[model samples]
Target chain A: MTLKEIKELLQAEVICGDHHLGTEIILAGGSDLMSDVLAFGKPGLLLLTGLTNLQSVRTADIIEAKAIIYVRGKKPDDQTIKLAAEKNIPLLSTPLMMYEACGLLYQAGIPGVSPANNSNKAND
Target chain B: MTRDDEFRQTFKIKGRDFSHAGGVSTEIKEILQEIGIPTQLIRRVAIASYEAEMNVVMYAQQGKLILSINPETIQIEVEDKGQGIKDIELAMQEGYSTATEEMREMGFGAGMGLPNIKKNSHVFLITSTPGVGTYLKMIFYLDHEKAS
Candidate 1:
């Protein structure tokens, strides 16, 4: 799915990267653990999370994620926004809670990842 | 841009301020990148740097992280002035942490900090006193000949 679809489906606000809504995302996952996201995320996946710290943006930076969706209407602070701008990471905020956000994205055809096998690959 | 005689940069960290927690690690990452460190090495340093960064921020009231880089090795030292770990052996175990709810909510303090650092680094050490403080060090050895 594309960022455009995610914005529409989750009813999210595009806090940054409005011009890049056309960027396509292959897979997505929802988790509160930034370490797990960094530890488990696939190369091509988008991250949906409730933890909207600057570290969250930094975690997205490490993995080079497509975008980040802040569920439950959490808008990032100025520092986080500035970092997102610096990193060129697309950031969004949604009123939908974490579970619903994941469900909508999944229903929209974006699926969660199985990191057990991926962890082995990361180890290798 | 210039490092100490043997080490690259030695920074003093003040813990629990929360705002400046990740600053030292970010700087170290930038320097290593500028010096043309390899991706695997860079990522390894980042993981260790970040773990060490969070440890000082959340666990200690005050601490310092030092970064030293040379042709052969990259070394990081973190010293903290918090209440030291009660059981070093158990704390080394995965899925163990003394992190508060606020810290955990931020997605760190997952009990993987030490383990991740140990995994990424070639050599690791941790020493702590219950009333005094804690000192941690990690070294990543690089064969410059092989890398070049």
Candidate 2:
């Protein structure tokens, strides 16, 4: 699905990068934990997170996430918004909680970045 | 490229600086992008570098991140002055963490930093002194066939 469809389905507000709404988003992962996102996120993955901090934007950029959808009506500060804009990673705000957001996306045929059968164990 | 043909840069990280955390890693990513590093390799380097930088901001007084790159490899070295890890083996575990509430509030402190770094790098090394500091060196080979 495209980010435009997600925005309409979730009734989300585009906090930044409105120009990027046309971008395609096929995979997503929802988490408040940045480390887990780092571990499991794939390039171009859409990140659905409740954490509204600079690190969220940074994590999205590091993992090459296509965009970030902030759940639970949370929004980041000005610095975080500035960073997101600088990185060209779009930011969207939604009133729904994390679980609901994930469900809606999943129902639309978007899959999680990590497969359910895979273990989270660190191989090191 | 030969050792003589390399790009090197150093960035300083200040502990407890939540406002500016992850900035260095962003710059490093931009540098690597400008140098034409592969997107997949850049993502790996960015993930490992950001994790290392976050550790310094969360636990150290101050630290330095050195990025040295050549045609064959990308290397990152982080040395910090602060309370170091007492048990390296335990710290490398997936769920082990000593992060504070503030760190968690930022969506970190899940105890996956070191292992995540190791998972992304071809070579990972960590050394620390409980009272003194910690040091990390991670290398990623540009050619997967040569990495072993």
Candidate 1 residue pairs in backbone clash:
B13-B64
Report the C-alpha lDDT of model 1 over B110-144, residue by residue, as the tens digit. 88878877777888999999978889989887774
Local accuracy by lDDT, each model:
0.79, 0.92
Candidate 1 CAPRI grade: acceptable
Per-residue lDDT over B26-66 for candidate 2, one digit per residue giving the tens place of the 0 to 100 score? 99999989979889889999999999999999999999999
| Winning model by lDDT | 2
Best by TM-score: 2
Instruction: Quote each prediction's TM-score.
Output: 0.83, 0.95
In the range A82-101, model 2's lDDT, one tens digit per residue, is 99999999999999999999
What candidate 1 keeps of the native contacts, as a fraction, is 0.27
Best by DockQ: 2
